[model samples]
Target: MSQPDSVTFADIEVAAKRLAGIAHHTPVITSRTINQHTGSQVFFKCKNFQRTGSFKFRGAYNALAQLRLEQQQTGAIAYSSGNHAQAVALAGQLLNIPTTIVMPEDAPTVKQAATRGYGAEVILYNRSETNREELAQTLAQQRNLTIIPPYDHPHIIAAQGTAAKELIKEVGELDLLLVCCGGGGLLSGSAIASQTLSPKCKVIGVEPERADDATRSFHSKILYSVNNPDTIADGARTPSLGKITFPLVLDYVDNMVTVSEEAIIRTMFFLWQRLKIVVEPTGVLAAAALLEGVVKAPQAKIGVVISGGNVDLKGLGHKIMNYEL
Candidate 1:
């Protein structure tokens, strides 16, 4: 069985301290409309407003800030679909560490542009032709750069846990904590915090139906793999949970669920229309589970993390305009 030796609440506390001035203490919001609709007192921890427009900033800054002086001088490299790329790029720029990001050629143009705008060199590769991680490792060896993975690292998970810590602290306790899962960094990290802080709270991870490998793995207690899922929730398209995250998830998470693509798109539009916030498809997975009645918890005090606001408006414009939500 995998364990959370890689992360702990204390580690999250340290990470929170490291991110105090650097990362945004994003708002914990509530909606009477949503509460009325779902019959639950929902408290949303809006990471959409976080620096770099996602919770990835916390992990990125924490890991980069802790890099050895030698590693910092030599710089860092990373592979990300989108959010993590911008995060590392911006964090590297802030920390005066040079960064290089390997991104999919079909990644959101907005994300690609933001990554480059942060002063990181961007390298695009065809997903079908090349393995991103291998390319990143090769490049890292060539450049003597540290690899800052999207997930699968201790610092990353611990830092990601800070969001849950913040939510629990501000909101007191939760009956349920719904988190979106990708590589399981946020899900496992949040579950660890929830289990420790609000022991009674049921921590559930949500994924797109098209990319339900994590949910499948959770049920079977075996690692499962998916190759480049074609879901709108791009962040949740990771092949499978990471080595560290898989065990942490198995240990901490209470349940796992999947939401249909219609549910995902509908819930995202609902947030935008009702909450007046821009959340990407991946960001709405957890909310989709809750709002679409996939994980019904009537009258429960639900804590939901609205993960990111980085919508690829340029590329997904048509889909957004005509999404009959």
Candidate 2:
């Protein structure tokens, strides 16, 4: 999928309309400490507070809503680590469709259970030997299920754009906006939205150092992937950029930066300790960029997308405590 010459303002508006009552119009949070420390008045679009504890729900529900009648009846299948799986599962439940999710055997138990609790049938595969895409395709072919790609579809991008629409409505205008990149759905949608809503604002993407596909793709002007990433940010661990989203990121995204695993972990804990928000590792990368000075904010305004909050408490505690162990 080549890059779209332009993802228009109307496209984003339509997406906002499609997601109007279905997806959460999540709140924008402000903190005096964040403002003082970052040296900018930060507006955090807290999708972590969104249903399914991730912004993935917005895109998933929107994509599901746009599916043809036949596709809906046929049901949908997806492969995801956690948040996206749960989002698709919940969306399928709400739309009264059968959902099947292929997750790695090593995926966080909390996330796996949450997806199942949403009424989707969960299939576990060996992360090391099986390719998730191949598994998803096999299932789709066998079950006659429509594949709802995690972040590659236009409908998904449109749906994700609504978060920016809501943010701009609440924060007026921003000089710079930061979003964490996984498969580039949220980042691509954010670029489209920021371009439309605040034309002068620069949209940047943050990624974990271990899964810096977006950053590499931006510099190489080609798509990149990590076959098997080793990071705690499971949501941002897509092996490659989508054919559609890669071009979108290359063309529209102003900059892409990476943060260290330690930085990501520190930022996650900072939000938990200071902002009193429980965010997943991927969700914390934007804040990590700010805290680590990966990209200094432009003075006008700053908006950061806090993507998800579905961390396993016991596991997270273990990670934090056992860092040196």
Pick by TM-score: which candidate is best?
Answer: 1
TM-score of 1: 0.97
**Best candidate, lDDT:** 1
The clash tally of candidate 1 reads: 0
Off by over 4 Å in 2: 1-7, 321-325
Task: Give the poorly placed runs of model 1, Cα more than 4 Å off.
Answer: 1-5, 320-325
Residue-pair clash count for candidate 2: 0
Q: Candidate 1 residues 132-225, lDDT tens each? A: 9999999999999999999899999999999999999999999999999999999988998998899999999999999999999999999998
Q: How far is candidate 1 from the true structure (C-alpha RMSD, Å)?
A: 1.4
Per-prediction CA RMSD (Å) = 1.4, 1.8
For each predicted model, how many residue pairs clash, with residues at least 3 apart or on different chains? 0, 0
Candidate 2 clashes between residue pairs 3 or more apart in a chain or in different chains? none
